[model samples]
Target: MKNIQVKWWLLLLLIISTTVSSCEKEDSGNAGRLTETDFMVAAANSDLFEIQTGQIASGKGTLSEVREFAQHLVMDHTTSSNELRILANQKKITLPDSLTEDNRAIRMRLSGQSGVAFDKDFIEVQITAHDEAISLYEQATREIQDPDIRNFATKTLPILQGHRDHAVMVKSKIDSF
Candidate 1:
């Protein structure tokens, strides 16, 4: 009788432990990502890095301009990514660090092009990326609940819009070529 009671208690404890462990695993999995707004920011920032990297590798632009522009991209995106990561951590939200499939497709297309073709594609994607960024940031500026986050969105929107303008100008010229 005592052995039977001991066996049942052990089984109950094991089941409870397993249930707790699984719940912990699930919670941790959900904790590492960003909220929707931050996620979109990170996604756009990732594309910025991708474009900079592709441009640097292609070496298509005037060497000085290419290097300077690449520096700006890397610094800007790195700061954005880090900020989003911090926010995600605080919010206990998981963010996708890798580019989405569509972004990846664009990256692959850019990788395949050379010289003027690469420059045109790069500028074109920059316009689209910044357009999306501005739209999303504009929405988030109004919608986000956190004061700091809302401010971040609001503050970043104009810079993104400016980039979009520059991209549009460059793309127009490239299209002419």
Candidate 2:
């Protein structure tokens, strides 16, 4: 009787292990591809970082143009964040609440500057960030498998390009000064 009980327990364990392994295999297929959840979380985090850095610039920048750009960043990114949140909710995705570690470090560095130095650093950072954002959106629009996210990326690329163009103009002005 005890031997029979042990055999049954072993069989159950074997079945459970097999099921779990198959599930894992299915879940991890195409590990190189970016998932929808990954895209959404990354998008949300980017918005948060931009908004935070823009707030810092608005408070610390001495240049009127820089302050105005910062305000635009805060407003535009905030709207994008809200739209992303609604889409994530509709899709049952949970986005992260804070910036990534790298972005937080950028924010920390930006927070330490003042006056013209702050304006230059802030504009430089914005240009780099916007360039990255444009590239990211372009990649997502081209490569993302999820249709909704791909569409979102397609719609966002133009705005990112505009921001990058504005940043470039600002950098040219700064160089002339």
Indicate the residue-level lDDT of 48 in model 1. Answer: 54
Instruction: Give Cα-based local distance difference scores for all models.
Output: 0.65, 0.85
For candidate 2, the lDDT comes to: 0.85
State which candidate has the highest TM-score: 2
Which portions of model 1 show Cα errors greater than 4 Å? Answer: 1-67, 172-176
Write the residue-wise lDDT of candidate 1 on 60-167 in tens digits. Answer: 553333334445556666677677668667766676766667777777776676677667667766666777777777777766667767776776677677666756
Worst 10 residues of 1 by lDDT: 61-70
Compared with the true structure, what per-residue lDDT tens digits does model 2 show for residues 1-177?
A: 999999999999999999999999987876656678877888888889889999998889787778888888899889888988988998899999988889989899988889788889889999988877776777677668878778887887787787778778877877777
Predicted structure with the largest lDDT when compared to the true one? 2
